[model samples]
Target: MSPQKWDENHPARILLLKEMNEGRIPLDSNEMGPAEVYYKYHSTVEFQVEGMEYNSTFTSRLRRLREQIRRDQGKPEKATKTKTARKKKDVSLTWNENHPARILLYKEIAEGRIPLDEKEMGPAEVWCTYHDTLEFQMDGVEFNDNFATRLSSLRAIVKRDQGRAANDRKALEKAMKNHPVQELNHRGEPQWNGSLAQALLQQDMAEGKHETMRPSELWEARPEYKEAFSRKDDFRWKIRQEIRTKKYLYTLEYRAEEKLRKNLKKEGIVLPDQDEDLDGVMDLEEMEDT
Candidate 1:
């Protein structure tokens, strides 16, 4: 083919040039002479099947396929990070019935008033005063600064009265005759019994029969009476026992809700829709977890 035709894009001419350049075809003319060589080449062309003459054709096809694959497989986008919100902690105060200040404070709260701080006299004295108020025979009295102070003074008086009563009882018992008294029975001539001695002792045991006394009375009393009247330790032991027996377990559910509502109201916090039964709204499972 002409060079101009070869450059102009003829498929057959391109294939022939490519085969000759790849050394797949031999170019020797003297061995076979021109006529025989031409005939032999023609015969070989008719009988032999053709394949890719060079590795470049295979590599070029592979490069095109790889480019196609890269185009089809797109780049992945980056993921965005998320933030989790933290849960809020419960900040409510829990008051127990057994707490010395609880009853007094709760009483004031129930009466729509606030209690004064116990810092002035001391926590122990304040607690004693609160306890005295429980047994104090008064109506419509409210707990405040003045009330706490007065209650503390009253507790002292009650303690003193208890001591005096115990002292008076011992004196009366000692003065009673040691011998048994003679008494006639329904069907007997005479009977010897300690009924009089027992009666005197029982009379001394009666409550509210003795006048109030001070803390110093036991020591300040006559020397002979000191041994009989000294019962401060016994009284303290009894008081401790009574406290253990009388202490009540308090349920916090209703009280907690009421206090929470009151505190929220004071802080201007608006609550969402609520169940009428507050107990039902609280999660028992969560409470058990705590």
Candidate 2:
């Protein structure tokens, strides 16, 4: 019901005021606040039938009355200017409902899908969890940034708002840094053994990491490969040995197709005619083994 519909002595006003006084309700009496609880009650069947506004105008009346009562009793101001200024700065840092990222994050927090207190969660872990969620759009808001960037910004702002400690932030940064690897064995490479180095090389090959050059030329130009192999003769022997294997040949083909597909995709080209053939040829199971 509208504030005009009720007297100060009305039971609705009395009960609402009681709830507010007991700290059982939010006095979200401002236009900017969500006032979720107020709206929940205002949307009751009786009030709905009366065509009450969901704009929270009723709470403004309660707010003014509460202030008047406090002033009459000679109560001091609850918030200091410094505190108010800090709050204003925090509000500016926070994303509003209009931000596409906020639309998803707010929904997730409200539904308990994601933790409301970001300070308790590690930033990287929270970021990982929000990756897929950030990809979704709510209420038709368009997101210009990619999912990773959006989640990164959202998480940082949340941590800032919660006053995440400097040491805790340093801990988060330490966790995000790449951990050092231990070379327990020295089969060939000083930094990495033959098995680990070969695995890394094969994975890179599968991902089309190298430019369009012969394996020998790549081995000569890339220092990592020289470190991994230790000798050009050994590299040559290994390539000749691996090329006989079915998995090796499949990996080469996969890298070639991946390179072509990526280049074509950048130009907005699709090979519709060969998509079925490509799908058939790109055996994921074999690629996984490679």
Cα-based TM-score, every candidate = 0.19, 0.27
lDDT of 2 by residue, 130-191 (tens): 54331221222233344335555665565665566677877777876755455543573555
Question: Weakest 10 consecutive residues, lDDT, candidate 1?
Answer: 84-93
Local accuracy of candidate 1 as per-residue lDDT tens digits, 1-290: 32233222444334443433454422221122222222224333322324322223422532343343335545232233222101111222233342223445555533434323334555455444544332221222334565555445544544566679999988777766564344654433233133342233234333322224332442343342233234445333433333232221122444555565454332222233345554333355544533
* CA error at residue 248 for candidate 1, angstroms: 30
lDDT of 2: 0.51
Off by over 4 Å in 2: 1-4, 9-11, 26-37, 43-51, 72-74, 79-85, 88-90, 93-290
Worst 10 residues of 2 by lDDT: 133-142
Which candidate number has the best lDDT? 2
- TM-score quality measure for candidate 1: 0.19
